[model samples]
Target: MELFNQIFVDPFVTMYELPDLLLQTLWEGFVSGTLYSLIALGFVLIFKASSVFNFAQGIMVVFAALTLVGLHELGVPAYLALLLTLGVMYLLAFSVERLVLRHMVNQPDIILFMTTIGLTFILIGAGELVFGGEPKAMITEELGLPTGSSDWDVFGGIVIFQHIDIAAAVIAFLLILGLAIFFNKTRIGRALRAVADDHQAALSVGISLNQIWVIVWFAAGIVALATGIMWAAKSDVSFALQVVALKALPVLVLGGFTSIPGAIVGGLIIGFSEKLFDLYWGVPILGGGTESWFAFIVALLFLLYRPEGLFGEKHIERI
Candidate 1:
C-alpha cells in the first residue's frame, strides 16, 4: 500500500498541493522540447531532400557553435562572427556536394548513410583540432539574447521564468514559421520538394541535383547553428553537446523521419513526459536518473502502436 500510494497517490497529491511547481516543470519541458524540435528539424531537412540519414548533424551543431565562439574569441564582433559562421557552413555545404555527394550519386542508401558517419568523424577531428577540447561559455550577452528571470506568483507559490527560455521559445516558433513559408512558397523550395519526391524526375526536368544538394545542406547547416546557439546558451558550448544527438534520436523516432510538424509535437511529448515522470515518480520511487532513458522508452511504445508517427503519412511499400 505504501508503494502504491507513493506510485500513484502521493505524486498527485503533491501536484495538487503545489500547483506552481507542476506548472514550472511543464514550462521547463516546453523549453527542452523546443530545442529538441530544432535539432530534429535539421535531420528532416537532409533526409527529406537527399534520402540520406545524416548522422553528422549533431557534430555539425557543435562545430557551428564552436566556430562562432572561436571567431568571437579572436576579437571579431558577435554579429560578424555569426556571418562568418554562416559563410563557413555554406562552404561546407558546397564542398560536401562537390566532393562527397557528387561522387556518391546513385549509390545505395546504406552507402550514403555510411558516408555521413565517416563525415561525422572528420568533423569531430577537425573541430577538436581547431577549437581544442575545452568547453567554452556561450556569449549570451554578446549575441543580444535576453538574460535574467521573471517570477509569477500564483496558487500560493512562485513560478520562475527565465528570459532566455522565453526568447528561445519565441525564436523557435518564428524559425518554424519561416521554414514553412520558405518550403511552401519559394521557387527553390519547390525544386527541393521535387528532388525529395523523385530525384531522377527532378533531374529530367532540368533541376540541378548538385544545386539542390548544396541548398539543402546549407539550409541544414543554418538550422544547426541556430540550435547550437540556443543549446549552448542553456548549458555550456562543448564537445559534450554532441551527446545530445543521441537524445534527439528518440525525438526523431517519435516525430517520424520526414515530418516537420511531427518533430515539434513529438519533442513536446517526450519532453513533457520525461520531466513529469522524473519529478513525480522516478526520483521518489526509482532513486532518480530517469530522464536519460525515459524518452526512448516512450518512443519505443509509441512506435509499436503507430509506426508512421503521429503526423507522417503511412507508407505502403509493396514488396
Candidate 2:
C-alpha cells in the first residue's frame, strides 16, 4: 500500500502542491518536444516521398549545425554563413539524389534503407574529419536569437520562460506552417505526392524522379538545419547531438512515419510524458535516469496496442 501510494498518488500531491514547478517542467518538455518534432518532420518528409528510411537524418542535423558553426568560426559572417550552410546542404542533397538514390531506383525497400545507413556512416566520417570531432558553440547571439529568461507570477508562484525557448517554439511553428503550405498548396508538392503514390505512374506522367528526389531531399536538409540550430542553442553543437536524432525514432513510431501533424503531436506526447514521468515518478521509483528509456518504453507499450501508430494508415489484409 505504501509503495502504491508513492507510485500513483504521491506525484499528484507533489504536483498540486508545487504547481509552479509543474508548469516549469511542462515548459521544458514543450521546448524539447518542439525540437523533436522538427527532427521527425525531416524524417517524415523523406519517408513520405521516397519510401526509404533515412537513418542519416540524424547525422544530417549534426552536419548542418557543425557546418554553420564551423563556417562562422572561419570568419564568415553569421547570416552569410547561414546562407552558405544552406547551400552546402542543398549540394549534399543534390549529390545524394544523383549518386545514391539515382542508382538505388528500382531497388527493394531494404536495399534503400541500407543505403541510408551507409550514408549515415559516410556523413559521420566526413563530419568528424572536417569539423575535427570537437564541440562548437552555437552563434545564438550572433544570429540575433533572444537570450535570458522571463518570469510570471502565478498562483502565488513564479513561472520562468527562456527567451531562446520561446524563439525556438516560434521558429518551429513557422517552419512547420511553411512546410505544410508548401506541401499542400504548391505544384511541386502535388508532383511529389504523385511520385510518392507510384513512382512509375508519376514518371509516366512526365515527373522526373531525379528532380523530385532532389527537391525532397533538399527540403529535408533544410529542416535538418533548422533543427540543428535550435537544438545546438540548447546545448553545444557536437557529434553527440545525433542522439537527439535517435530520439526521433520513438516519435516516428508514436506518430506514424508518414505524418507531419503526427510528428508534432507525438513529439509533444513523448517530450511532456518523458519529462513528467522522469521527474515525478521514474526518479522516485527507479532511482533516477529514466528519461533515457522513457520514450522507447512508452512507444513500445503504445505500439503493442496500435502498431500502425497514432496516425498511420491501417493495413487491412483480406483472408
Candidate 3:
C-alpha cells in the first residue's frame, strides 16, 4: 500500500500542492513537443511521398546546422549564410533525386531504407570532414532569436518562461501551420498525395515521380534545417545531436508514419507525459532518468494495442 501510494497517490498530491511547478512543466513539455513534432514532420514528409523511411533525417538536421555555422565561421553574414544553407539543402535534394533515389525506382522498401542508412553514414563522415569533429555554438543573437526569461506570478509562486523557449514555440507553430497550408492547398500538394497513394497509378495520370521526389525531399530538408536551428539553440551543435533526433522514432510510432496531425498530437503527449513522469513518479520511485525512455515505453504500449497508431489507416488484409 505504501509503494502504491508513492507510485500513484503522491504524484497527484504533488501536482495539487505545486500548481506553479505543474504549469512550468507543462510549458516546457509544450516547447519540447513542438520541436519533436517538427522532427517528426520531416519523417512524415518523406515517408508519405516516397514510401521509404529516411533514416538520415536526424543527421540531416545536424548537417544543416553545421553548414549554417560553418558558413558563418568563414565570415559570411548570418542571414546570407542562412540563404546559402537553403541553397545547399536544395542542391542536396536535387543530387539525391538525380543520383540515388532516381536509380532506385520501384526497388524493394528494404533497399530504399538501407540506402538512407548509408546516407546517414555518408553525412556523418562528410560533416566530420567538412566541419571537423567539434561542437559549435548556435548564432541565436545573430539570427534575432530572443534571450532571457520572464516570470509569471500565480498560486503564491512564480513560473519562469525563457524568451528563447517562447520564440522556439512560436516559430515551430508557424512553420507547422505554413507547411499544413502548403500541403493542403497547393496543386503540387495534390500531386504529391496522388503519388503517395500509388506510384504507377500516379505515373499513368501524368505525375512525375522524379519531380515529386525532389520536392518532398527538399521540403523535408527545409524542416530539417529549422529543427537543427532550434535544437542547436538549446545546446551546442554536434553530430551526437542525431541521437536526440532518434527520439522522433517514438514520436513517429505514437503519431503514425503518414500523419501530420498525429505527429503534433503524439509529440505533445510524449512531451507532457515524460516530463511529468520524470519529475513526479520517476525521481521519487525510480531514481530519475525516466524522460529518456518514457516515450519509448508509451510507444511500446501503442504498438501493442494500436499498431496502426492514432491516425494511421488500418489495412485489412484478406488472408
For candidate 3, which ten residues in a row score worst on lDDT?
Answer: 175-184
lDDT of 3 by residue, 1-319 (tens): 9889988799999999999999999999999999999999999999999989999999999999999999999999999999999999999999889989999998999999999999999999999999999999998889989989999999988999999999988988898888888888899988988988899999999999999999989999999999999999999899988987888888999999988898898888988889988999899999998988999999999999999889987879999
lDDT of 3: 0.92
RMSD of each: 1.2, 1.1, 0.8
lDDT of 1 by residue, 75-103 (tens): 99999999999999999999999999999
Model 1 poorest 10 in a row by lDDT? 175-184
Maximum-TM-score candidate: 3
The residue pairs in collision within model 3 are none
Q: TM-score for every candidate vs. truth?
A: 0.97, 0.98, 0.98
lDDT of 2 by residue, 1-319 (tens): 9789878899999999999999999999999899889999999999988898899999999999999999999999999999999999999999999999999999999999999999999999999999889799999999999999999998779999999999999999899889988987899989988988889899999999898888889999999999999999989999999888989999999999888888999999998999999999997888989989999998998799989789987879999
**Candidate 2 regions with alpha-carbon error over 4 angstroms:** none
Q: Would you list the rank order by TM-score, best first?
A: 3, 2, 1
lDDT scores of the candidates, listed in order: 0.91, 0.92, 0.92
